[model samples]
Target chain A: MPFLDEVEAAIPALRRYAHALLRDRSAADDLVQDCLERALSRRILWRRQGDVKPWLFRILLNLCRDEHRRRAARPVLVPIDSVSEAGGSGGQEEFMNLREVHRAMGQLPEDQRAALLLVSLEGMSLGEAAQVLGIPDGTLASRLARARAALRRTTCRAPDRPDDVRGHRP
Target chain B: MTERKPIDDDLLVRLHHGTAAERAELEALAARDPDIRARLTDWQRQDAAIRALYGPVAEEPVPHRQLRLFDRPARRWPRVSRIAATIGLIALGAAGGWFAARLAQPPARGADLVAEALQTHATYSVEVAHPVEVPATDEAHMIRWLSKRLGHRIAPPDLRGFGFQLIGGRVVPSATGAAAVMMYEDDIGRRVTLFVTRESGQAETEFRYSGNGAARGFWWIEDGLGCAVVGDLPVDTLRAISVSAYHDLIDA
Candidate 1:
């Protein structure tokens, strides 16, 4: 496939991954935008590389790191109203359950969360996800286990208090 | 009849992410073990929740800004030339004052080398994948290749005493010529890099300190090559490591 077409095909997955990483809709799209721009500019260098999907993802991950660095001093704020903004299609109960999981996921350390999302959410093989995160397979496995245990604790412990996910709500 | 203990959490996580055979095995075990079945169901529910939360983003139409990148002219050279031309103009603008200072005294070339080293370190140190052109696993070949490219027999200074093991090295462009960077990471994943470039007829100089938040280093001219040790370490710790590297790489 032509490089551009191959990159285009990966856009949806890229958006999903970016969205999962950033947890904010516009910021996630902006990240995807930056990743695509960098990818386009480096088309020549990428031509010699294999597996455009992982490469594109690598670029996205790099940009994501840069974004975090640029905003290191500022905490990312995701407002409650915005959480319900992306709620058009799924059933209300399923959507609320997902929101609970999302809130629980937000509490995870970035490394562990990224590993879980890549393997569980993105359905990537462990090897591929390990490569994407730039960590060893053992490290990725440990992170997945930790993330799962943490999620079970947070999400499963209180099935009733959905709105109290953050615990700061008065 | 003996009851099989539910599989380990690590194995269960792997099974959730494993190949078809492993997944089938998970299913078989879950069929007989209620605990395993409950755990599997919990993970499945989590996956479903995640998919429900963000899967629609994938279904959304590709944003116009992204799709428009392809619509732009596919020619790369024009953009490259435009950037080059802008850089050329910027250099021309800076050269007037730069040359004026050169007439009064010799330019502090060490600073430029340090800046280049810092930039190289900043760019590649955070890389998780493809951190180096040659990985440390192929240490001999990397040494040979880097030495060939650098035009000198340069050794990656042994930093094991400081708990930083050589991860690998890459050849990067420098103001004077090609520069070689050797990256090392300690146990907790903090990285420090040694940047070296050969300069003919250059006089040896003392250490010069340069730093930004969480990244500090010192560069010097020793044995006719510009060398900088950079890391996001404390100034004192970086100094200790740099001093050790200077002796190992420059004096020896």
Candidate 2:
């Protein structure tokens, strides 16, 4: 019962993370479904000591990677209308820019995106992110740096935002 | 006055990540240097934007219908039943086929040899001049030659009562190895052959009847030897010929 309750509690976050990774509502839902099913089936394999949230995210991310690999050979076209709809909100230009950032994120190499998402978006510590991605912490840090640089270049935003907490000192 | 050292690339990356201790160092560095503080601000904003784009995805609702984790009762039973029935039918069909084959050919060990002899006799006895390799006039040589080849002594049975004479014998292959068939002819040109070979290691004396083309045969094995009488004669005539041949061969 505790395991099931844990899984249920993780579902919303799983959906959110999957949606970020896949960028398609249906595909994200399907990924979440697969992750949940796998988690349920292999419930006994979960370690009781750690947070189930990261474990669930790890499963979902691995499934997403597998899905990406399977679809790697096939050419995928994101419809122009979906892109426009994603970019339409003028009040949230930054959010729209964020969506473009995600599109750029999608184009970033999978390992880099995975490293970035695990650390920055999912709020995982570098050590935990490294463990989840099955890489060394140093390697994780390098990947995160590369991913951040790539995102900055791809989005082409100014180096500083006035509203940011750490204002430009120079 | 002297100066201190610079940060390495690994340390710069760590500074970009900015742990609690690293943040304090960055604040102190910002008080001392403006350029490093500006880079830190850019890094922080970039981190924030990346977080904003992906952070809310985890809160989205998971569509239950897409999962297919739960099965519908209407669809489940039929598939299982169909698979079970298919397996059952395959097993039943195999058992039935095996039973039918067993009934058609009983477990008699000498049946195959007897059948093979009857088939061979019926096939070759219809030949005119080539029915026997050596003519009956050379009876001793024919017997000795056929006996040497067949690994058993073979004497042509006298079918005088059946109005047939031994024309001669020839060596041929048999199911039990080499065999000899001694040809005989009646007055009307009807020919019958007494097919002989060593018993195929069976103890029972069993008779079988077989027909091919217009020829009928009565074959039996006894005392480590097998014999078949084949001709175009009626059933009674074939039986009579076979009995007379059997008596003469056994007596000899």
Q: lDDT per prediction?
A: 0.74, 0.63
Docking class of 2: incorrect
- Please give, for residues B1-252, the per-residue lDDT of candidate 2 as tens digits: 013333322344555455788757757876776555655565566556655655555444446663344343224323344336345434533234235334546336445655666666666677765877899999989989988887666788878878998888887787678888888888988888788888645663434455554666666665467777887787667766776776556544
- Candidate 1: where is the Cα deviation over 4 Å? A47-49, A73-81, A92-96, A157-170, B1-6, B73-252
TM-score for each prediction?
0.56, 0.47
Which candidate number has the best TM-score?
A: 1
As a whole number from 0 to 100, the lDDT of residue B187 in candidate 2 is: 90
lDDT by residue (tens digit), candidate 1, B1-252: 113243556667677688899889889988987766766777777877777777778988998988988777445324344346345433433233234334434336866887788899899999999778899999999889888988777888889998999999999999888899999999999999899998767865545567655676767675467888999886556766876786567322
Task: Report lDDT (Cα) of residue B20, candidate 2.
Answer: 82
What are the per-residue Cα lDDT tens digits for candidate 1 across A6-117?
7899999999888887787888889899788767754533423467898788778866775575467697665432445543346745423767777888899887777888
* Candidate 1 chain A weakest lDDT stretch, 10 residues: A161-170
Where is model 1 chain B poorest over a 10-residue stretch in terms of lDDT? B92-101
Q: After superposition, how far is residue B66 of candidate 2 from its true place, in Å?
A: 7.2
Candidate 2's residue-wise lDDT over A1-170, tens digit each? 34455667777667656655566767767788877776654443354455787778777776676566556779687432254322232434543365666577777887877777666666777767776776777777667666655666667743454322122211
Residue B87 error for model 1, in Å? 29
